[model samples]
Target: MDIFTGLINGFDIALSGTNILFCFLGAVIGTAIGVLPGLGPAATIALLLPITYIIGSPVTAVIMMAGIFYGAMYGGSTTSILLNLPGEAASVVTCIDGYQMAKKGRAGAALGIAAIGSFVAGTVAVLGLTFFAPPLAEFALDFGPPEYFALTTLGLLLAVALSGGSIVKGLIVLVSGLLFAMVGLDPISGKIRFTFGSIGLQGGFDFVTMAMGVFGLGEILYNLESAMKTEIVTTKLGKVFPTLKDWSDSKWPIIRGSVIGFFIGIIPGGGAVISSLASYAIERKYSRHPEEFGNGAIQGVAGPESANNAASSSSFIPLLTLGIPGNAAIAMIFAALMIQGITPGPFLVAEHPDVFWGVIASMYIGNVMLLILNLPMVGLWVQMLRVPYGILAPVIVLFTTVGVYSTQNQVFDVYSMLFFAALGYGMRKLDFDPAPLPLAFVLGPLLERSLRQSLLISGGDLTIFVTRPISGTLIAVLVLLIVGQTVFFLKGRARA
Candidate 1:
């Protein structure tokens, strides 16, 4: 009952005119980026972070950013279905069946299922957030430095565990990300480690610049190198609304995906991407026509789309409740929240119920807004597929350059972005995954800070890490994962 009352009050606050306008703006911008290839939510949010300073209210800024994050999730599928391009990693699964469905003239069905599934998942996940976030925040408040370190270690290991191929390559990329993160100022000594004597290097790599170079410019370069092109197949405007039969097929996948994705997302790792892939794998295994996978399987689109949205919603649990961002997008939101003089944690819910619950309530509203926005606009998004890369490539580069330059108003950052763009292109050509690198970059500084803090608290005694049950258990699990992977690889090599 208290939760119900709180949620109602949140609705009142979120629906206010100013906040509502920001929500609309965020959705519109996010959808625009999602429909376009290359640019993603992380880059968009990072580019917009500086603008939050002008907005002057942390709650409003964070709310708007949240709207963009989820809105991009809604929008990313549009390109996947219409152009065979995934605007974001979470939408990659959408391309397998989504693009195929388009080729088979089932574009309407794929788009409809994606939007409906996302709507259902986003709504349910918000309910999960409203109820679960406060309690988790409370639990996190009790964590010490050692516990935090252990949790981060588990997260990194899970990242390695979930890496699709070549654990060695994943670890290498993860280490590279950590090294790149270390290029900034030293957290403890305030000493510069990798500045290379350049004043510009003092600030280290900007997240926005790195993401834009790797995702946006890198994608453009890759597409340019390939002669392959995307054609928008004519889609018969069948029922935009999903049928009962569609519901029957998708119901269990949605529920299962929501449950699976929500929990994975709360774990403070690559939860969104992991959940999407996991949902697709599960749906494929349980599907009546498993062979239909990668060939416009409705279950393929339904399960992953739901899982990704649910994961996106649940990833907020850690950020809003514990001030620990699970990913880059959430990290940007954290920066926005901090600028508002609000420290997100268990006490935040009690201290600022309006902020917390208002954001929660707005998610519900945002989901509805996205569904309404996506349905009537399906034809328009499909039209976007027709945009020629010859024209689009230069526009992407322009946005990338402008967005990176806007971060610090420095030409140096733009140069760094172009450098990363070339690096990203090289890595993609080498079959290296860029995903793990960003996770490592994001987590590296936190890992260093936590380690140092734990040492200080324990008087430099490493035993403190193992003395705590939860932390110790997590460390042990990481070790087991590492060893398990090694053993599996050895066996495979021996068999070969």
Candidate 2:
């Protein structure tokens, strides 16, 4: 199919009353969650996944989820500038200069630049998705089972290597996630292995249940423990628009951030958080007046905000084209896609063009909605912050519980979510990143299937993984990452 035709048809689908309405709902909800500290896009999508079943259209469900992901990136800067608190982890870099700007009574300028930069970068990323995803999907159609095994193995290892934490801890989490995938029946034998004599365990863990428990309920519990009173900046915001000078200073940073973010977001595990951090480092290194960096530099605010938002947009490419999720949020959406009976991968464009193109197109509309929401209603979002976590926490928990129960109407599912909620909280307290676990869980079955298929083709030879061209290269890269992690681990221990 021609790219323009697919996009046009996508717009036709996206412009419908239902898709548009849900898209707006997702944008509003995503922005709301992003503005509220302790809740990020991944958890919000998990909390809302049950409703997608209710919506019943796979294309619409994915459109809404995509909106939420980028919308969270768009809204995250509000709290950073207004309260010196990061609304989500990706916004932490924004806090450095954003709060300083707010303290200096330039809150309006900082917020304005962030919104504009985000809009530009979001557009740039969507353009990248528009042209690149189709070709990538076409290229992936040639992959064999060995290649798939290598790809999934690489994905799992990348999750550990880029987890932005201790590699050892990431490996432990990765192994734990693989174990979670091992529960239920043995795939080839059709024999139950880990059920431990329970019927519910035979079906294994529902992805939605675990997602809500870990990302949604678990995050809330962890945040409530260390939650503190916060006050929005009291100084007046002079204007809601950036000045000529502000735009002049920010134009180049926004461009640089956009390019950097688009490429970084394509990596399996690197997403908005890492992209934003990388952009900040690059901006700092190249700035003419690096001394002004932590003291309210407009370039500091412009670059990271744009990078995070751009990363959010481009992160969809991997999931839409490669079957591998770009990050944890995309992994949750990948689970939602499966629940809707849609398999994302090379054939997705040919098999479900509506799901593929409608989703990509809806992001364009979502970006506009976010820009409109973030700009004119900046004040409204700040007011939302004043709604104490005391009130917010219970509401979230209630919604999360109800959402999980509604999915399968199974009591077991709710229990599973609560169990994961506890586990998720414990993981956070231990400084263990939960990102690798969900992603690992999502890819585990695929890796197993690929491994089994490759082995069958190679007559049970173990060398099959490294014998094929694509698989061989992927294995080489995987070995390099492992070796690099070893060096990193040793250096950390040496310093300790």
Q: Write the per-residue lDDT of candidate 2 for residues 329-395, one digit (tens) a residue.
A: 9998898899999899999999999999999889889889999999988888888877888888899
- The worst-scoring run of ten residues by lDDT in candidate 2 lies at 227-236
Q: 281, model 2: CA deviation in Å? A: 0.7
Q: Residue 304 deviation, candidate 2, in Å?
A: 0.6
Give the candidate number with the greatest TM-score: 2
User: Candidate 2: lDDT of 457?
Assistant: 91
Please give the CA lDDT of all the candidate structures.
0.80, 0.89
Candidate 1's clash total is 0
Residues 408-432 of candidate 1 have per-residue lDDT tens digits of 7889988998888887788778887
TM-score of each: 0.87, 0.98
What does candidate 1 score on TM? Answer: 0.87
Hey, what RMSD does candidate 1 come out at?
3.1
